[model samples]
Target: MYEYIHGKVIEYNYQINMKKTFQFSLCGQCYNVLVKLNSKAKKKKTTRSPSPSISIAASEDRINKNEMSSEEDNKSEFVLAYKLFVKTADGISLPAKWFQESISTVDKFLLSVYNKIHLMTKDNTIMPSYYFMIFKTQKETGASTQLVDEQDFIKFKSEYTKLAARKSNIGIYVTILQPSITS
Candidate 1:
């Protein structure tokens, strides 16, 4: 004899607590419905993607080892630039000459900094887009920065430029919590 237990996955009672049992014997439509429900449950059980912040831990270890290696070898400009960036971002405040030469793409550098600040931000209401400034050099001053949307990549760049300008001595510092237009 065929039987069908049409109920929620959680409420389903099984002989050995196995809720996925498709009733061993059932009609074609009932079997289809069970298969569909199984798919839905599978989707719900899947985990969400990891946030970018999780990368910080790994990057930190790589940075520390690189620093030790840099001290041992006088050469290695890449390590030197990365160290300068890490220091400046960590509030050590390096001179502008160090940043004049390229380290990484400005976008990548800014995104890393933005991610760091975003993770530290206390206010849940303020999105990453809201925190920004345009870093301008002495020559390229007076550039405008606008927050475009939720992700607001444009606004982030603008904010970076402004901070870079202000700290033209060391390097720009753009924080997610800081308000560009305080009124």
Candidate 2:
């Protein structure tokens, strides 16, 4: 016997010592109904037309062509942008701003950030190289990574993408690197 549950067919059978018969009683009534355990439905065998097989070299060529086309499409379609929240070491939050991938290098990004800070504080004595930025992950125990001018913005963009995927607030912490005194 078979039963349907949630649009799926399941076998229904209960046996005790290889015996299939079971007793059932209803309130003030006794009735008997016959059920066929074996169904008369038959499944039809499907026949499909034979398909021509391609040579291994032909298949490999097709795959390589597809991969090349996809690579070109990705290069043309790729656009990287960021909405950065800047905060100081003293916990003061600066206005958030948008940056495009066209900024290219971390040095350029730091310069732009320095310009923003300069506009607010009106301090021109400090250079962009004096301040370095740290990106902290979205988790409470997440480690902070420092961004350096030698690296490209793609690294920062990738880190941002990872945190953004978690749907949490992301910000960059900026701190001044004090000059070390020597004897």
Candidate 3:
């Protein structure tokens, strides 16, 4: 099962060697709800048309790896990011541009989340509560970014949120606790 985490602004769970880390809490209610939602999404996906990989694989088989190995290399560029899964009246969907880690300030981060909610609803009427789930993600393809000029660096301000097909690998970063002490 996928674990969901929430971001904290005030303090971290532990500190060592001048670095601080905040541990995410596992809420039973949230975990169960997400699991059910995930299962429904999986069911929907299975009922859809065949995946794009089928055609891509067929094309790849015809070409020699040595000659045309990089037909879609640019599509695989990666950026470390966070995935914000928001639940609203509409459904479960991600907020725009919330995946970028460069949202270093708390105010902007909150604003972006609210902005996405507003855009999704398109109504001035405020919702009573907001449900948020954050996972450390790697790409911001769904994020809307401003068009960059020809002269500017590609990753300027780390707002490259339009890249597609981000693969989230948060499990790779999790580690065990309860360190053993040497006498």
All models, RMSD in angstroms? 19.4, 21.3, 22.4
Q: Give the alpha-carbon lDDT of every model.
A: 0.41, 0.49, 0.38
Where in model 3 is the C-alpha error above 4 Å? 1-84, 90-102, 136-183
Better model by TM-score, 1 or 2? 2
Residue-level lDDT tens digits of model 3 in 1-183: 222122122235433333345445544544554565467557756776467567446433543342244323323334435443444444433343334444433344446555654565454454323333232334324433221231122332233343334333321111112121220
Candidate 3's TM-score reads 0.25
lDDT of 2 by residue, 96-165 (tens): 6655554544556667667765664445665656567776643446567776643334466666667667
Point out the worst 10-residue segment of candidate 2 by lDDT. 29-38
| Model 1 lDDT on a 0 to 1 scale | 0.41
* Residue 41 lDDT (model 2): 14
Best by lDDT: 2
lDDT rank order: 2, 1, 3
Better of 1 and 3 by TM-score: 3
